[model samples]
Target: MMRKTLTSVWPLFFGLGIIGVCIGAQGSLLGIRAELEGFDIRVTGLLMSAYYVGFLLGSLRAPKILQRVGHIRAFAALTALASITILVHSLIIDPWTWGLMRLLTGFAVSAIYVVAESWLNQAANNRSRGQLLSIYMVTMLAGLSSGQFLLKLADPASFELFTLISVLISLAAIPILITATPMPSFEAARPVSIKALYHLAPTGLIGSFLINTCYAMVLGMGAVYASKLGMQVDEISLFMAVLVVGGMLLQWPLGKLSDRMDRRSVICAAAFAALLFALVSGQTGFAADNRHLLLALLFGGCCFPLLALYLALTNDELTSDQAVGASSTLLLVGGIGATLGPFMISLTMERWGAPGFFWCLAAMSALMAGHAFYRRLIDPLPAAGEPSSFQMQAPSPVGSGLMKSPPSEN
Candidate 1:
């Protein structure tokens, strides 16, 4: 029984891993390529933001599209579109044109995720749900981390590096295409209203947006920031890797804390810590290469978990149906914040140079802290054992044939 079940779902995991690789390549490539072109920090930020705009739009529309196309067909088509789009980016150097392509890529990737997650949900049984999702999450983080290393393989100056990205994305389709198992139908869920989400867990939803805003800015322009600070290209990649690695390492411990106490407190503490790091790092002007490791550890490990905390916190308040709606709402809001982050951060960098990026980061973190603090006062704790609607499954579970899908509260 175990063997049969494992065989049935391996393709979904493989497919998701491939998709992760594709997404990671884009992020890695963007950091390197933007800097190579001598684009202003502000322009780089704007270009990066464009992708989020597409992602936001696509995520909202993807469920409906999947409902129409069916999972397998939708996955195949979008994967193809995503592959082709990355390849096109290699050929274009114009920031504006690249932004448009990125938007399209974002839309396509969103649909891809929708398809992938839906498939995983369908395949999962109660027993395997947790295992499958752990694999999926690991795959995502590893693929993303590995993608950054690819930057080392190719010269940033040549467009050939992007071709590699294109190739990787194109190849990602093969595992799914060859799988023999029947694909699952898309699960229908109720729609969630944005307004209702705000009312339910205002801090979590808002924090999700702010955290992504900071994350996107760092991801988009951090390489340039490193270069401006006199670090070499390889060092820049390492800087980012450290950040990601630190974040991955801290996910477990910090996650446990959030589960135990008021998540609002966790948000406030993390935000303050991140703000402090950003301030010190920005002021030192990247003088501490040795300390870069520390910055990445602090930001990526402690600061980055803010996103997860935001999700978990939001989930804490929701009913099953409300959880689905709230998660969807958080995605939309986070996407918007991500879209805005790079542009604003880059603009700040343009005016102040190196300090601009960190300053922007600190400012956002401070805002999150403020938001959390205010909400802490406005909202009282729920009585013990109060059932939460937003406690949606952290990820699509593994092993299980079908974990209950969150009831759509729409």
Candidate 2:
């Protein structure tokens, strides 16, 4: 019975894993490729941010496109488009050109997530929703981690690696395309009003943005930061891997703790921890001969979870439907922050040196933590038994303009 059950869900798990690999490769490869091609760090940051701009724009429009195209068609079309976009990177050298390609890739990939996640949600039964979601999460994490290691096998300086990733992305379509089982139809996108959500829960929304800003900055430039600090390409991969790995290790405990206590408190604590780590690690920079590996690990472990925790905490204040829409909106906001994070940090790094990148992150983290603390005093907490993790969070009136209707149920 157990074996049959496991086998039955293999396709969905595999599909989600592919999604993870696609994104992980995009994030890691873009950073490395930008540097090897001799683009300035700011350009690299701008290129990465271009993707987020695409993401934000896509999130708004993708639902309409998906509705007309249908799920499988939309997924296939976007995946193929993304593959082509990535492949173009191999042929092009100009920063603006690459940035445009990155934008298209981002828009397409964000739609892919909407389609894929909706499929996963549809396939799951009430009894198995949690299990399936957990499986999906793990697949995503592993696929992303695997993408990093793929860096080791390919030569980063050559176009072969980017082409190889494009191939992998193109191949990812096979399992979904060939599977005998039919996936779910896309949910019709809905309008998620920023004002309404703000009146509902403020802390989560703001925290969501802050956490996303941190994450976007890190993913966009952590490797570049490593390389500038004198680590080799392989070490850069390992550095990114360790940061993600630390987040993986802490996600469960931090989530559980948030469930039990004041989520605001949890977020504040996590941010403070991130601030401390970033201060130490960012200030010291990586030294000769991998002297700072431990600092990096500790820094990653401590700071990465702050995003997840803040997210989880934010969700704790939302309704189920609200949670879904709110999460997507928050994701869009985070994408914005992520897009800008690399560019801002890169400029700082160029002006003041490598440590400047981390100094920015530390300052951002501290500001967010302080904001959460202030909200705790000014706002009323959610009632007990609210679905914290899956509900859509509304920010206060002051920040209410950021909310939007849920993405259309295509």
The best candidate in terms of lDDT? 1
Per-model TM-score versus the true fold: 0.89, 0.88
Q: Write the per-residue lDDT of candidate 1 for residues 218-253, one digit (tens) a residue.
A: 766777787777777677777777776776677767
How many pairs of residues collide in each model?
23, 31
- Model 1 clash count equals 23
User: Tens-digit lDDT track for model 2 on 220-299?
Assistant: 78777877777777877887777767666666676677777787777788778878888887767876666466666666
RMSD of each: 4.1, 4.6
Q: What are the Cα lDDT values of the candidates? A: 0.71, 0.68
* Candidate 2 weakest ten by summed lDDT: 391-400
Worst 10 residues of 1 by lDDT: 394-403
